[model samples]
Target: MSTTYKVPIGPVHVGLKEPVTAWLELDGERIVGARVRPGAIHRGIEFMARERNPIQVIYLSERICGICSFSHVLCFIRAIEDLAGMTVPVRGQYIRTLVLELERVHSHLLWAGVACYTIGFDSAFHLGMQLRERVMDILELLTGNRVNYGVATFGGVRWDVTPELAKAMREMIRYYRREFTPFRDIVMDDPIAHARMRGVGVLTGEEAVRYSATGPTARASGLRIDLRKSSPYEAYGDIPVEPIVPQDHFGAARGDVLDRFAVRVMEVYQSLDVLEKVLDGLPEGPYAAEANLNKVLASLKKAEGTGWGIIEAPRGDDTHVVHLKGGDENVYWWKVRAPTYANAVSWPLMFRGNELADAPLIINSIDPCISCMERMMVTDGRGDPRVVTRAELLERCRRKTFDMMGRRA
Candidate 1:
């Protein structure tokens, strides 16, 4: 007779960066079923967006997730621009594309680092993070911020990449091109990485479609549905955009953890190439269209309309829907659907039939962002501490950091 038990990891786990609870039902060593709960960090961003004016909402949207911040604002701004029937300057379009690609490089690098760490490869994890800093430095140069780059504005970008900055970006890409080969070799040649990743957390193409998985997760499962190519927003239409499904890189897509990692790594190269092309042919025009917010708001008030916008964020397609109120500066309705929401559906499928020991790597493979998918968490006072004072919270944070550092040491 087989024995069954349940294993609960997180609400706070060393493996996860955000708040997520995973309950796994195990039969011996294998997981028979799993449930993932998200949303302890929900701040009602959509509701908050409805309260702010269009201009203010740009900043509000940017706060959706620190990593996907620019994508959020871009989707929101594009929705507003579409509602108002405004055109973005050509150079503005190019710059927007450039910033987004740079963001992709950084995001992918960050995920790669996390994946490495999850697999217990500290060297690759550190190397991935170190290489990622160059991308962050460029982001800082362009937007004056390392995270939450507030560059995309309504109908255009706030800052232009000057000739010198463009040159610097080119050099950065060149450096990445030189360094990526060794990184790829390290991940691909490692027998342990293959043993751990291949055939693990396999999601078939049919299953991926059923769950509506997106980004590298869906691409790994042989879905060729990148919004950049399918929808063609911003400069995607002007430049040829190719979706890197797993089969394109590997002979056949296994739709496993290894395939997901391969797709993201290949995408970093593709984004670097796209950046070069966008910069080389960057059109000459103003960074932002000349228009006063008051005039734009008046027009929107007189002729209110609903608009929907979608952009291929690093993780996947991020979408926004907005309805402008007649004779008001604020929107009547605002909706945001992030990639994590779509990808969340596949978690249970990935965890089923896998070992409990593989939980963290399987979870990391999807790159779950619980913060983006807001829900509710209830804690009963019957057996729990009611209030967590600031001192406790601070001490807990410090202890976690110290533990992590100790492990590193």
Candidate 2:
């Protein structure tokens, strides 16, 4: 008879990048069952939006995720524009698309490097990180900041693609095309990488659908679903994007860690193509419909309706909904549904029947941003609701850390 033991992978673990707890039921080294508990950090960003006007929320949304900050900002801005009935100029649309693809490249590179690091492939990891700087440099040249780029605005982008910026972007695209393949081949062609990743952390196509997995997670499982292709928005309408699936390229979609890795690697190439198209067909017009902030706010003040903005973010479909009250200058209520929230649902399924050592790789396979997905509401033992203040939360964090270190705070 076999006796099962319970093991916890995280809340704070060396293997994880972010704080998330996974309780695993193990029989020896093999995982029997798993339960994932997120919400280690609750930012309360959506709740904070209620106090600020539409214009102020743009910056707030950008802080949602460092890698995909612009995705959140664009999504939030689009939601507000939807309610306000504002139109983005043609040039603005193309510029928005350009930034979106650039962000995708940046995000994929970071994730790939992190994935390599998770598996102890340090050389590939370093190469990926080095390759990522090129895109970041172009992003900084265009928006003046690499992360949390304050580029997207209410009606359109705050910045325009000048001739110098365009030349830099083209150069960056060519650099990636020439340099990225060697790094990708380093891992993908390695027998040791195949031994570790192939057939590990499997989530079948049926499982992906049942769990409502989106983005590359779903695509890795052989689902040909891409929001850019299905519901074309922004520049995706102009530039055609076909979803990259494992079966299409590798002859079969095993829906394992390897497939997920392949999907993301291929996407880097796809983004390069999209960036080229965006630059070649770049339009000439006002980048922002109305650059005057006061007028944009004044127009939004009178608009009273709920609007949604959904886009194919780097991870997956990012959705934002905003409601504006007629007389109120501040946003009435706001909600965000990030891609990690959807992709995380399939984690337990992937964890089943895998080794305990594979836990970290499986969790990191989704490229999850725990901060983007966490939303917490505190309550007492009797189910009585209570608000946990910022200072209280900080104290709790300190106490937890001290306790873990076998000390009293």
Candidate 3:
């Protein structure tokens, strides 16, 4: 006698603006099987960069996603800079590190809010968002814009954080102590939160290692590979690093939602620690090598060769590859492999055999960036799931408008 029946979860709700679906076989509300329906939004962000010119492409990179905008630019710029055989100034590197860490704080807080919402803790969601707003404010003050801050440019930064902003980082850290510590205690130490999470969705250390997971996911599962330490891009190598590990960094890494959550919480603190060190020895130099637009354009001279650059983006490792061609409009091929590529692979393993109730918890635990994930469509029958996207709908509207025209050329 068998009592397992299929119960579908997601195309996640408003709690997470990302679209995702999980098919779980349930035995009276207990999950017996699971499958992650991810291809819903693979908008082809990966291959799109190849079509645009390098200088003209920074803006397109910015549109990759609002939350991880700077990191996207950082990755692409690092790749292009490597191709040009150029190195940014030491001060510029420090500035880039600070920007990256600030973005990390911003992103972690945003994830905290979304996680809270997924778990139905609305108050915590609002609190996390409010604190997250502080980091966003800092970004705007330094970058001259909110969201897609175009602060990173090849060979260096587009803008500098003045003395005023440097001071603000210290005070803001103090304010965040009040906001994050309490929230951290509740999410990390509270029994209720633990009951909801804890061993509910356990990804063993071996599984995490075998899957090649990175960032907090791997860290949570006890995989110790933060690219900052291993690869040491930018100036992370210059500053000392303390792993935001569980069980005090020496214990066996826990591959669970709580462990993943705790690693991220502690990582925010470590980011601040790194930034303070970078600032203490912040260098001084011109951001980009060229002094004027003509010089900058001339610097992009197409060379016949191939190269690659890899950066530790906020979500994880993001790589960019370039193959120079003699006359291929600036360069030959620019390829980027964002962290999501590896992160998504772990979803199936994470969700499988987990209870249907823990779908959201596990999905967000990998922290799949849907905007980064791209296209979203409901692939199941009887759902009448309006599988229309803004592009398709707009194209249809444009087609109708052209057909309605009384005169045509």
lDDT against the true structure, each candidate = 0.86, 0.91, 0.73
For residues 1-409, write the lDDT of model 2, one tens digit per residue.
9999999988999889899999999999999999887767778998898899988899999999988999899999999989889999989999999999999999999999988888899988999999999999999999999899999998789989999999989999989999999999999999988888999999999999999999999999999999999999888888999999998899999999999999999999999999999999998879999988899888999998889999989999999988888889999878899999999989999998999989999999999999988755576878665667789999997996577457311
Off by over 4 Å in 2: 381-409
What lDDT would candidate 2 get against the real structure?
Answer: 0.91
lDDT of 3 by residue, 1-409 (tens): 7788876666756534677777777777677677666556656554565565676677777777777787778777777777667778887888888998898888888887777777777888898888888888888998988798877776778787778988998778778866678988767666777887777677777887788777777778776677788878788888856556676753766677878788888888887777678777887767555546455556665544556767666777777666655456554455566676677777767765666667777778766676665433444477554555679889986986586353221
Better candidate number, 1 or 3, judged by TM-score? 1
Winning candidate number (lDDT): 2
Which candidate order results from sorting by TM-score in descending order?
Answer: 2, 1, 3
Model 3 misplacement above 4 A: 46-51, 249-252, 374-409
Full ranking by lDDT: 2, 1, 3
Task: List CA RMSD, all candidates.
Answer: 10.5, 8.3, 8.4
Supply the TM-score for candidate 1: 0.90
